[model samples]
Structure formats: C-alpha cells, structure tokens
Target: YVVEELDVQNSIYEVPLELARQELDVKTLDLLRLDRRTLDLADYLAWLDGVLHPTRECTIAVVGKYIKHQDAYKSIYEALNHAGIANNAKIRFLKVEAEELEKGDPARILKEADGILVPGGFGGRGVPGKVRAVEYARTRKIPFLGICLGMQCAVIEFARNVLGWQDANSTEFDPDTAHAVIDLMAGQRGVTEKGGTMRLGSYPCRFRPGSRSAELYGVSETGERHRHRYEFNPAFRARLAEAGLAATGTSPDDRLVEVVELEADHPYFIGCQFHPEFKSRPRKAHPLFNGLVAAALQHRQGR
Candidate 1:
C-alpha cells in the first residue's frame, strides 16, 4: 500500500510518518490539549535524510572467511554503514573472501579499496589470507581497522614481517608455534565448555595518554564489548612495541591489551581486541569506525 500510495523514494520512517499525518486525525491531540510542538520530528527527518543520501563514496575491502553469508557479519556491515553516514559517504564493501586472498594477489584485489577492514572471526582456515590483507594495508599506508581475530592477524603480520619472527602466529592457529604472539588468556586455558567460555560482554579500556586510539575517542578511558579469548601475549609486548606495533589501550590494571596501532608513520592502522561494532549506532558511529571512514576519505582523495 505504501509503495502504491506514497512516493517510492520516501524513507521507511517517512512513510509511516506521512501515513499518520494523512490518515490519522489531530482530534486526539486536540481533545487532550497536548502541545503539537512536542511532536516535532524535523531533526530526526534531517538526520534520516543524511543517512539515506550521502554526498561522497568510499570502497572498503572487507576481508573475511564468511563473506558468502550475509548475516555472518551483519553488525560489522551495519557499523560500516553508520560510519559511512557519519562521514557523509556511502560505504561500498568489496567482500574479498579470505580464502581467495590466500591464493590471489592481495594487492590487485585490494588496490581499489579506500580502506581495508578485517572483522572478528574464529579458526585458522583463511588466516593466511587475512594476514596478507593486513600486510597490504599496513605496507600501502591504506586506512585499516582490525577487530578481534583481525587484530590478532595484524599482530602476527607485524611480528613475522617487522620483528623477524618468521613463524609468529596465534596459539589458536598454531598451538605449538615457537613464536606465539597471540595466546589464549591465562584464565581461559582450563575451560572445557564451548558455551560461555570466551571473554564476553563490556569491559573498560584505558587508552594511553597520547595514543591515536585515545585521540580518536577523545577520552583516556572508554568501555567496549568483547567476544574473544586469545589476547596479545604480554611476553612479546616489548618486542612488538620496539618494532612499532604499540599496545595503546589496555585493561584497567594494564594486564590485557585492548588496542594496538602503528601511530608513527601510518595514516590509520588500528586494531581492537574488543568488538566495537556491537555498540555502533546509526546516529552515533563508533570512534574507531568513524576514524577509519574519515581516513578512507582522505586516502580516496589522495589517490
């Protein structure tokens, strides 16, 4: 009925609003004598307009193993949209299958991307491809944001290539690798149950005073949700930091690394162990995503 009666271009919210205005009577408000000014939706409509119509565009290559499934990374996709809306740009996702990146040239596949993002995931099936994507983004100075396992891959790539740890890997992928840059949290080793075993829910992260993570967030501390067990092994923190992969955010006690970034020369290379997408909303984009989209716009213009 809406498609046939109302302008097809109207927003879904606008359609309902128009229907109420056209079909419903104002007698109810009149009888109650409620001020009509209270029902003003001008600000909301303007914001909706911005979301529906962006002025610019940027392509983001989302490297992941489950790209074939639409709902697999639904939150990540939606968060990117929110970020795009915040930046006044349409986010065009180039869903590059992680397994495909394992065999294909990442440079060629990702050359057109204004930004590169690798969302959270489990297993080791296409880790090599994800690492390759991280490497490309890091080397090319392209805007990059890695979440959860994506952050782990970023550390592994940096350790292997920059730190000269050729076999650097996450214990989740290589339980016996000599260089376990990423390891299961000490508290999680004894867990046998698959359900409710991983580190989950919101946690506070204290950002380093001058780090990019803190700068982007505009605060020294913030809470972000998590859904992973493996973490940046503290044993390799100094080594990694010496090579430029700095742990810029950590747990309140400084026992766990929550955020990592290469802030020296890179435009925007950040990885967060927590799932920032979980808290993102259309009206307020997460800072990490906001920064990535803004950096992507800059990268696009530079190209």
Candidate 2:
C-alpha cells in the first residue's frame, strides 16, 4: 500500500481487494466484499496511528544477561511496544547488561531509565547483577517489573536488604545460603532429567482482594502461563510477608506464590512468576505490561 499509493492503509483486507480490481481485472471483487459495517477498520487504524506516531516517550531499562542476542527477549520487547502504543508513548529501551551493572554503579548506569525491568534467565552467571538492578529499582522508587528469574531476584534482594538477611539467596545460586527465599519446587528435588520437566503451560492464579495486581487486572482469578521449576519458597513466605513483600497472587489452593509486590508507598513495583509478555497483544496489551508503561510515563513526568 505504501509503495502503490493504494487506499488500503485502513484495512489490510483492502490491499488484496484493491490489487484484484486494479491489476487482476476482477470485476466481482466489490460484490464479494463483506459488509463494510461488519468489517469496521476504525479501531485498527487508530492502533496503527498510535504506533506510527506516539505522543509521549519513556525509557525502560531492561536489565538482563542476554543483551547481545537480539531475539533473546523478543516477546518481552514486543510486549513493551504494545504497552507503549496503548499508552500513546514511544518506548525507548535501555538495554543494560546484567554483568555491567555488577561491575559499575547501578544508579549511574540506570540514571536515564524511567522504569527498570528485570527479565527471566537461568543459571548464576549474571544473577548478582540482576539482584543489584532489582535493589536499584526498589530503593530508588523506580517503576519496576520482574518476570520469572527476575521475580526471584526481587525476592532475594528484599530478603537481603529489607529483611536484614545478609545471606539471603536463591538455592539455585547458593545451596548453602542460610536464607533460601527462592528454592527448587518440592516436586523437582529428586528429578534426574532436566528436559521437559518445567512447570509449563497455563495455571489459574487468584489475586488478593485489594492488591495492586488485582486492581490492574480487574479480576480476582486468571490463568497465566508458567515455564520454570524453581518458585518462591513457602517456608520463607511468612517471614517475607512480615517484612512487607506481599504475595498478592497465588495458585488456586494458595500454595504457590504467583505474584509479589511491595505494599508500601512505591508507585509501581511488582513481580510475577509467569511471563505476562507471552500474552500481550498490539491492540489489547496485557494488564501487567500496560500498568508498567503507564507507571513509567508517570515517573518520567514526575522527574
């Protein structure tokens, strides 16, 4: 359409119809067309307009180890784009290497970000950096969103800093740590094979009545997809809750922690065990990503 100057920018369906009439000499193209009212393209055009020309802008620093690979976090990047479109803001991604954060000062490396996001990853290679990034987001009052391993990092950071447990860590990194805020799922303790053994697929999650997560989702119950084996250790849940990291969302039976958030005065700080980005769409952004983008814009304005 852009090349041919066809009046099909409104609806993608128009492109083929126009091509048939203009080039292929299809006389019945108009008759074959569906009712215009049934195929309204207004909403699609509006969404495209927002994408082509966003009114606002904010930088979200994505702290992760896979910064070198473009497609490593493709879904996450697209989810952020969808969220930016919904908010009428252009997302400026500040891709910070997790290792770099460990080597340099986090505040200086992340000073330009209006929000900080720690994405999922495995192993202990850049975990300390991820934890440091979470700490930066927490203490500096920046809008933050953590997913999977990122969420684990948040819990570890809170346990060590706020809960005053210097040795707080995930057993995945330090099995001998005195405080294992994040640990392997009970069922996976004796598993020999690692392949195809993760807690995969959709699972029901119930949100706390007055939590920020529930407010953003506007629903008490929903299904989020999971792809990890390690989870928030239930053994430490009570102590963590006492120190103010509330597990706002959990499994249907309330046994597994699905979401955690700071209940205090921070504008927006939440971490989810599942990858909400997997469900985000261009026209219908996922609630969590939308919330993060909205909060990021607010933080930018405040600054």
Candidate 1, which segments miss by more than 4 Å at Cα? 1-37
Query: For candidate 2, which ten residues in a row score worst on lDDT?
Result: 1-10
TM-score of each: 0.89, 0.89
Which lDDT values do the candidates have, in the order given? 0.89, 0.89
Candidate 2 segments exceeding 4 Å error: 1-37
Model 1 residue 78 CA deviation (Å) reads 0.7
Over all chains combined, what TM-score does candidate 1 have? Answer: 0.89
In candidate 2, how many clashes are counted?
Answer: 0
